[model samples]
Target: SIKLVLKMLDRQMAVIDKNIDGMLKEHFAEKLALFKDFKGVGPCMQAALMGALPELGQLTHAQIGKLVGVAPLNADSGRHKGKRITWGGRATVRTTLYMAALSAIRYNPVIKTFYERLLANGKLKKVALVACMHKMLTIMNAIVKSGIPWNPEHQNVSKNA
Candidate 1:
């Protein structure tokens, strides 16, 4: 009985996936196509981003990070310095981006290199992953803003600002 229920659930998820793909093709083809060029942004991630972050292209890199809850915030008070932490934004978007960053660290060259560099600098795994998520979001924002596909040679200018 459990197996049967699981199978039914899987079937339902498949159908939902199919419908999402069709909708993306029909209404958000350009955006979908652009996101598809990103190495680790699969259908689910693309859909989550498209639905949650409608201001993708228009916002600055920092704004996008804040919106997704990936931006590091200072926790200091007066002379007592505190660690930077991320807080308060769209939970679903952050969760989806976390998963995408996991995949990207494996498949995306830029993300992989950045992750490795962070680790080399003694950053914690989670810290590095969050940074990677921020970088990925910035890149996506830049791409959408510029109306260009993923260009390996293109540096994210907004990241430095």
Candidate 2:
């Protein structure tokens, strides 16, 4: 009986996945095509971009970062200054972006290089990871704005994603 219940749940999940795939293709075909070549953007990230942050291609890099909670903000109060940190924004999208950044750190050359550079410069791993998330968001914003697929050589990450 337990095995049957698990099988049923699996089949339902497959159906949901199929429905989501179709929906994404139907509404975001152009964006999906452009995003396909990006190294760390998987199904969850795609869904997050489409559902949680529909303003993906519509905003500037800085705007997108703040909207997704990846940009570091000042946490200072007069003489007693606190550390700069990310605050506010779409929590769901931020969580999804975190996972995507982790993947990019491993596989995306530009992001991997940036991460290593930060680590060498004495940034903590978590700090570097957040920077990567911001970078990835910048890259995605550029790709959507330019309507260009991922081309490592012709990257628009000049703003340094």
Candidate 3:
């Protein structure tokens, strides 16, 4: 059965669609097409990205991470463990990002290599997946904000990667 939350979101989108002015509608429709061209990115995920990062076209890497709740937070004390993962941001955004990460693992070489490396190190599946998602968000932020696309050969080399 369809969930009530999905039903509510559908109604909300209907109202918003009705209210968008003609020019903004046209503009978004056009840009949305461009977004759909990215591998594994669909309309729903693109919409989620735009909604989560409204200024996505303008955000820097760090700003984008915090917005999506993937940015690491300090969890250390005098003798505690490493940093803690953030857990209190937009849930829908994080879910969509998680899907993107899975797709990136299948189709994006750089991300795939990173994901394999995490797995090789014996990380739990979910933990490695979250790390992949964070990496995805960072790369997507740089691409969307800079009006560029993924270019493995041209990206700054990271030794840890």
RMSD of each: 3.3, 2.8, 5.7
Worst 10 residues of 1 by lDDT: 152-161
lDDT of 3 by residue, 30-135 (tens): 4454444455565556767765667665777777777788877878888888756777667888888888888878887777888899999998788888888787
List the candidate numbers ranked by TM-score, top first.
2, 1, 3
Worst 10 residues of 2 by lDDT: 152-161
Candidate 2, overall lDDT?
Answer: 0.91
Estimated TM-score per prediction? 0.90, 0.93, 0.69
Report the C-alpha lDDT of model 1 over 8-86, residue by residue, as the tens digit.
9999999998998898788888877777668888887888888888998999999999988999999999999999999
Alpha carbon deviation, residue 125, candidate 3 (Å): 1.9
Residue runs of model 3 more than 4 Å from their true location after superposition: 1-25, 29-37, 156-161
Clashing residue pairs found in predicted model 1: none
lDDT of model 1, residue 142: 89
Better structure of 2 and 3 per TM-score: 2
In model 2, residue pairs whose N, Cα or C atoms come closer than 3 Å (at least 3 residues apart or on different chains), thus clashing, are none
Off by over 4 Å in 1: 1-3, 155-161
Full-model lDDT for every candidate: 0.89, 0.91, 0.72
Question: Cα RMSD for candidate 3?
Answer: 5.7
